[model samples]
Target: MRRNDHSINRAACYRSKIACLVFFAILWVAFYHAPAFAHKVTIFAWVDGDTIHTQSKFSGGKRVKGGPVAVLDSEGNELLEGKTDENGMFSFKIPQRTELKVVLKASMGHLAEWKIPAEEITGSGSESNTPETVEKASDKTSTGTGSESIKTDVEVLKPTIAGPGRKEIEEIIDASLDKKLAPIYDMLANTFDRGPGLTEIMGGIGYIIGLVGVALYFSNRRRKE
Candidate 1:
């Protein structure tokens, strides 16, 4: 029964190939489990004074290291871009005061976005209306040449006064809070990127086993034929 021997040899060859493929697949999953379950991409952002900070992570709290990040304005125009650090964190001085959208591109085609409302963005826009309004008010008041008009100009100027000590105070407060809240921010990012639960992991394992069973069943069926 050389025919029988040939069929058996063919089946053995097929089994070997399947075994090799399965072994490599399992090895890959073991080595890259973080990115294997990386479908859940999360990004979080906050403004600290004039700077916007973002943190990104994949499933299992794996930092999205070296990933590209884009900062876009309200109109979807790219403002600036940067890459995440080892800590999955990136920071940039607040771009334009418009609403900002930060997009992170993680490994394996994963993407996450975070938005900062315009009101939360500090600093003036490209044009500061305060200076223009005061200039116009001063020009108008000077034409009158009266004490009342000068007093009105003073009132106009008072509102535009860039409270000098205010910025220093804000810097101090931000520095203090930055140190205190670093861990909290990390915790929140990790919590959001926790990915699947134990139940889901077990379900995945069961699915893999089902696949292996199906492969074995077909192989045996082919041999029977």
Candidate 2:
């Protein structure tokens, strides 16, 4: 009877150990394979005659404030002067349907620009377009003066026309605001694409399971001793 009771107890201990291992394995898998939610990029830009007011935000939804927002004409003439607000919001106007350049000058001297297509600015609302190419232009003046300027040139390869009439320009502007924001959409989508993968998830789960197995093995050995 004593030997039988001892065997029963040993069997019960093994079952308990298996149950604990299974519980931890389930938890590890759940954490490892959890779905990552998609993030949105928010950009706001206002236009008035060859000028644009613009702002940008990252995935965490924090705006870049106090940045210099410059609007330039196709000829590189400075048209409107503006600065980003406390929340990174900006407002300015540009010439009607004219190809314009929007630039952001960060405090650390980092510069980014997007060329506004002529079709994007003709009408009533704001539109966004990705600058096809980005280059770092010299912000320093050639003249012996120490004055600095953010002078990057972005070219609009394809000019989109807003047709002939005023009404047509208005219609085009209204229709393209959503399309203008395409660059920002693409940026966020690409970020998610480059994030963690299924293999990484599986590896994380496997590591956690291995740790739990090690702990259980020692626990069982001690019990037997």
Candidate 3:
């Protein structure tokens, strides 16, 4: 009857392992807390010329009105602070030339961060927009500074055929593009707000069940042999 006893012991050991796995699976589901908190807050930011604009929203697409926005550098130093308006937007001039991190302090102790790469910013380090150059272009023909100092034929002739200066035209185009592209940026931000859905949770459960089934099958086959 030694073989019979051996099989019984093997069966008992396998049963214990299965019980532990089941216990752990239940705990896993219980402790699956990160995904829930991940969607609680989200912040998105974009650059418009010298200005950095941010949008903050809660989980259900509600705007975080009047929320405080803190701008931080890559090294975690606070650069500036501002508050969101009714539309949940906070804007500030580019403080300095480096990678920026925008943090949103929403109500109910919710916080989120958005990072803006340095390259995305138009200029760097106290560099202002080239209104001076635009002015020069406007006055170049008047000064008759001669073709020697003029870099190109376009600069020499730009003042003649323009209702607005070239810089103004560029500003207009950029504004138009930003308006058209705002919806797309918002769509992307919304995508990030989503966490795991029911399908993923169900799949995790099924995976645990299937793993236990496989273990049980191997244990049974070994015992039978």
Candidate 4:
């Protein structure tokens, strides 16, 4: 009778240990496979013109909040507008052909305006020219007055030109904004996707440890029984 009771208790302990192990294993697996889904955005502003402040905000391929506020335009049109939080901040959702003016009101009646050229405000314009290199021939001929031909290398650099149309202008702004916000987006996406994977692995480890604890507990309990 005593041996039978001891064996029964040992069996029960083993069953409990197995149950705990399975529970932890399932939890760990669930954690490891969890989806990552969180995002946040940051906004920044640059004063492009004396009266124009270009503010852009972004998060997860969307706009954030704030604006491309124009405090004054060439026509004296005062435009003040706030951006959508869902869209991230500065948005180019306006009509392609319509010209946009932004106005901003600062503290104590301070005001500023920015006039984004139509082409520059749109994305359909040609790329602006950057400086170009001009190599002059180094061969020099005497200018006849004992002065050798002053053959020097001359580099002619071109000034950058603005985009040609509203659509192009908008495209340029978007491209510039993207360049600024790319790093932030990369970090957020990585954290959102990788965070869950790490959490799951940790949970799995915890579960395995729990399984060991359960086995030890059962063993001790069976001895007492």
Candidate 5:
């Protein structure tokens, strides 16, 4: 009779673990994918040369294309504004040499921002400021008697390069990065689609059964005392 009771207890523990594991796994996936329990929308942006590229999406991987995008200066002045494309992508050139703020407003009252530093845009070949080399030239000029010549040299040092246009460069970088990141995105998408696998469910059930076994062992010891 004692041996039968032990076997029954072990079976009961395994059954309880499996039931709990399956219940929680289904509940978690349902809450994660269901619109009623979905999370807020999000946005991310990066600068490729003079153009800023952005992507916006809801928590469940739905694109937030056609969303309003606003570009602002450091002092909150509007610089430029536009809407995202069908793929939730927005690209815009830096208007002036100042700190920038890009804000995206999606549907359902979702909003996000990307704060870009002034150094990121400025000091580039396309932007302004080459004062380091200019200062060195001015120091040499100070040794002579041509202070005005130093000012002229400063202007010459601020050389601008004329290469591919902003939009073209943005497209090139985006294409390159997309190629590299495609595999990672595919892996994540597959993971979400597959949900919890058989091995994972079995592992979770095993852990729970081990915990219950330990508890039963302690309880049995206490009963004997």
Candidate 6:
């Protein structure tokens, strides 16, 4: 009877060890694959004049890279459809002003939207206030006598006509901005994509160990009974 009891205890200990190992292995696998199974996406967008610019990213700052973008007017009609560039940016010029809704579809079911009010597109806010400032400046210049007014007007018109069109200047500015921002974007992507941190891994392991301990405690109690 003594020998038989010893054999039974040894068997129970072996079973408990195996159960704990199996539980930890399952936990590790679940943690490792969690990110891949999750659907996490976000988007940022803005309107500049008639053009709408957008960027889409995952939780880890991984750009949608290239994906379809749809522009809809307030009436729910599709105005334009295009794809994002490598930088996760896309722009479309609208024919007229209206409240706009831009939706990005990165993949099968991932979607994000940006709603731009009509006032924003029509320049009815701070943008509309700009002309008043210019008019006030013009009035001051006009008060400087006819000759000075003529000279000032000529100087302003010369740069407007001879230097570059508004569109060209805007493109050049956008290009320079993209160049400067590229590194920052890359850094964000790298930083976020590292996935589960040390704390998360440790916490998962702790949970598995605790669960195994509980299981063994109850199991040993049952064997004693």
Candidate 5 global lDDT: 0.69
Candidate 1, residue 47: Cα displacement in angstroms equals 2.5
Please give the lDDT score for candidate 4.
Answer: 0.44
Q: Quote model 6's TM-score.
A: 0.44
lDDT of 6 at 217: 100
Give the candidate number with the greatest TM-score. Answer: 1
lDDT of 2 by residue, 1-225 (tens): 999999999999999999999999999988784322224333445444344546654445456566677778899888876777776667664544578787766543356566767665753432433222111111222342522121111123222432233334334655475468657644553353243579999999999999999999999999999
Worst 10 residues of 2 by lDDT: 146-155
TM for every model, in the order presented, reads: 0.54, 0.36, 0.53, 0.23, 0.44, 0.44
Clashes of 2: 10
Clash count (model 6, backbone only) = 0
- By summed lDDT, the worst window of 10 consecutive residues in model 4 runs over 132-141
TM-score of 4: 0.23
Runs in model 2 lying further than 4 Å from the true structure: 1-53, 58-61, 123-225
**Scored by CA lDDT, what does every candidate get?**
0.75, 0.58, 0.77, 0.44, 0.69, 0.68
Query: lDDT score, residue 110, model 6?
Result: 78
Better of 2 and 3 by TM-score: 3
What does candidate 4's lDDT look like per residue over 1-225, in tens digits? 999999999999999999999999999988784322224333333222112223432234333233334333446654445543333234333332225555543323334433556554333332332123111111112324312211121112222432133334345666677667666654543343222367889999999999999999999999999
What lDDT is reached at residue 212 by model 6? Answer: 100
- Give Cα distance to truth, residue 85, candidate 3, Å: 3.0
Q: Which stretches of candidate 1 lie over 4 Å from their true place?
A: 1-15, 18-37, 123-164, 197-225
- Residue-level lDDT of model 3, residues 1-225, one tens digit each, is 999999999999999999999999999999775322224777899876668888887777777778889999999999999988887888899888779999997766689999999877743222435677657756764567643343355457685653444555556667777778778877776676665689989999999999999999999999999
Q: Which parts of model 4 have CA positions greater than 4 angstroms off?
A: 1-53, 56-80, 83-89, 96-99, 125-225
RMSD of 6: 11.6
Q: Per-residue lDDT for 12 in model 1?
A: 100
lDDT of 2: 0.58
